[model samples]
Target: MRSSDFCIAGGGIIGLTLALELHRRGAEVTVVERDIPLKQASQAAAGMLAVRDPDNPPELLPLSELSIDLYPAFLDRIERLSGQRVPFQTTVTYQSVGHSSLRPAINLPTGLIPGDDGLSRLEEHSLDPRQLAPALLTAVRNTSVVILDHTTIESAPPAGCLISTLGPWGAPPAAPRKGQMLAVSVPASFGLDYVVRTEHIYIVPRLQGPRAGQAVIGATVEDAGFSTHTEPASLARLRGLAAAFLPAVADETDFPIVDHWAGLRPYTPDNLPMLGEIEAADPGSTKRFVATGHYRNGILLAPATAHVMAELLTGEVPSVDLCRFAPGRFGKA
Candidate 1:
């Protein structure tokens, strides 16, 4: 029988990050994926570290704060271990406010926004997940981490502990929020460098490496169950939204539509990720744990999620309170 200190059931960013942390602590780790690593929402993420996004749940604030703080060190470790460069695409996010009663200011110091008409420029960060994925994969491969790609894990893997980072595959009391996103390559002088967000859509620009001049326009969140299919109509609507914000995207002659894709995000009823031990099944069963249902914040929450999970597995005190994200809260997750 194969033995490992941990056998994680998902090979996405969350699983891989947590596996790396565990292996760093001298644990034998094996990551099992149903298909391949970084093939799902991991690569599809816009890579926004939106710690100050007002739309986020209030319960997520503490974790988000810890995550954004850990981001620099996280990327640094990934690059150092993998021998790759994953630079931040942007350091500011401009959130547009419509003509209405003004909301509370975001409380972020800002200088001159390129076009600061009615946008709230916040101190945020963004990166290209496409770049992050390969670095993380390479880093894990360079370690003692054993990755079982194209492998389906049983309910309980033969390990001292089993962590279910398995996105929506077996999530409970949760549904897959399908998202459609498209990307376009603009000229270096595209006149836009920061991330942009409106009520319905977001635009993120890449500022470094071969990905520079690439802007990603995303994301239609639908209740479509596990549909990997991208709708042309939806893509057109997304393009229209982008054009409304930046008219340059409408002209395909100058800026070409490079890629389009669809993926599913695991979201719980409360919209909070399920983390921590599976206490409901057996009060004493620390052998099984879950860390899924991150929904739209998986990219933002990856490093923090791994940090806490590793602490939990190693019997160390968690950095943040996990009461609000307890798995099995909806009955035996």
Candidate 2:
């Protein structure tokens, strides 16, 4: 029966960021989570801040670009508020090309040359999700945000503006697309300075410090329907992919798979996030809003989503075109 100016369902990264934003604008906010906050997709992400990725839908480019530009300020604000250092870096992302795409005239790491293929370097960055999740939680707790973890919502709450950030398994057009990932320990001799990505896998090196010489290797997309089970076959597949590109990972006898996990990304038919208000469930009822269906970009797109959502909720005009993301576009699907 808790209430506030806004009630957010699904306390993942998107939900926590939205709460932080709305609370900054002087709104009392409550976040409800089915499990501990940041234990789902947000925790499982490799935290790549990428907009120019080939995998990104063209329609999502504008939103992605906007979010990338806001990262600096977002990190600065959160770090100051939370009093925790978020491991982040602005490094190049080397996209490995095979015989199918891009010219093969370029050389890659380990004296690996692409025959009729090459590598494309883009200005990209990454954050350590292990650090980010806790920092975000700290920032939210420092605010007036009320978090009701281990709670589930049967329907929209009876009061306040309800905003749903529930990832997959929540509403229609938003279903679970399971992804499996693993983290491996690399040796100090393993010289991987930038994020490396081929068609199948990505390797993001950890920032220097006590956790230096480690990288996260992932992931496999499966339509297993809300399942987070980790299979050895899938882990082996990811390991093979990692070793194929970064031979150093395999050559280093000490580089062993330290951890593995799976998470569900919220998938939508159009592959675009749903934002804006849900038309009143019944006449004269309080309106609801949604900011889910981000899929794999949830961590990358969080700050921007929170910004625009706060704008919309506070009656301030959002700068971006949200028409395409409206829930009515699905028409009760």
Candidate 3:
């Protein structure tokens, strides 16, 4: 019967980040997770800080830029608290322009990211999730915030208010879209310094640790409804997508898939995050709130989400407009 001021429903990156912020504001917090924290989308992400990705909704741009802006300080805090270096990967992404809908970065004029071999170079920020996730987990553990792993919020001492940061369980009460990804080792001579992304695939080279020569390729978005199953056909298709950019990955004998995984992304009907308080479950009980349904942008939006959610929780006006992301949006119109 542990108790706290706020009990977070999920302990993924979003959850932990919010917890850190809330705690900073002097709120005693508790986090309840069904499984390990960061085991979901946070761990499965490609860690691309795709702030200017043209595919993102227009309403998301401000928040995206805000998050990317805060990334440096956020990473610093994580490193300071956890005492671990979350290795950085690259500061640029090479987006394939051929047969792709990608507009110039920041809607710049034509030839912004110069295209070569049908590929365009865009300045993007990316980090190694393998390093970030663990460091985040360690950072949280070092904090006074209570974490109840392998448990649900219901088990925590009843709190009048609850916020859900459960990444894929759909805090906005939406569906979970599954994504599958894989990584393969590349040779040093390959000199894959920056991120290489096609229409639907991205190849990121690791430059640190034992994974130095490995390139991470991802992912497949599926409305599979919480299914954890990874399909060979899906992986093969991703490999083919990667092959279009780096022919060497196509040869399993040469690259050899070192690791493969599947994760769920929270998907809302509007494809926007729901970041406001949930209407009271009962006339005067259960003041619920949701900070989920980030879909493909959870990793990218974490800092912004945490900042805005903290502002909302602390009764301060969120610095960014959240009307487009209200939890009850679907019920409107």
Candidate 4:
């Protein structure tokens, strides 16, 4: 039997980031993943690192702030150690009610304002998940870390500790929320350089050059667990919403379809992610830790989550207070 000081399930962004952190701390780590690192939702994600958006729940603000602060240094460290640039850019994210509605200016603690165009400027940024996930996997591969791809984690083996970083949709069937999305190639003239979010639709610009101009459209949340089917009615509603927000996109193509996909986002009832230790079901075990249920913020929160997990594993003092996010917050301790 193979053995390591730590074993992480789910090779998505969160899992890989945790592995990297543990390895850096001098603990032998092994990652067991079900899919090739970027082929799932991690690759399909638009990679918008928006934290200051007005729509975000207040309880999540601390985690969001921590992630935003950690991103630059996180990217720098990854590049220096892995020798690959993870493309990241800080830009103004916009949220508008309607083209004609008077955009209400929201006062933010960060001092950003709602611009004249009736859109709030969120101190947010984006990264190419397609590029970032693969780069992380490659970096892990180059190190002493072990990666097992194309294998599902049927059960957890007894260990000194176990961390579950599985996202919301990754939980058991009863707790899953399926998210549907699509990617399309647009003309350079579309000129959508910023992330736009409305009540019904969101448009995220791809890091690929302007010529190949790409964006992800249609993110309908449904109760269907892990279903990847693209419903025509939902697609039409999304396109209509997009057209209402950006007339230019509506004028360009009636049917701007490209690639459609879906994935389950592990969602808790309250919409906050579940983190921290799970006392073993058996009284004799040492400790079990979980860092899962991060629905859309998986990419944005990866670094902070990894750091917290490492601190918990090593018995070091944690820099941030994790009491609120404890896995036990979900139910009976």
Q: Best candidate per lDDT, number?
A: 1
TM-score of each: 0.91, 0.93, 0.91, 0.86
Clashing pairs in 1: none
Clashes of 4: 6
lDDT tens string, model 3, 224-328? 887878888999999988876676678888788888899888888778888988776467787778898888888889999999999998889998999988877
lDDT of 2 by residue, 127-245 (tens): 88778888899989988888888887754344478888998957898998888988888765656677877767888888654456678888898999978999999988888888776
How do all the candidates rank in terms of lDDT, highest first? 1, 2, 3, 4
The lDDT, on a scale of 0 to 1, for candidate 1 is 0.84
lDDT, candidates in the order shown: 0.84, 0.82, 0.81, 0.70
The deviation in Å at residue 221 for candidate 4 is: 0.8
How many clashes does each candidate structure show, in the order listed? Answer: 0, 2, 0, 6
lDDT accuracy of residue 39 in candidate 3: 83
Estimate the TM-score for candidate 2.
Answer: 0.93
Q: List clashing residue pairs in candidate 2.
A: 104-116, 104-117
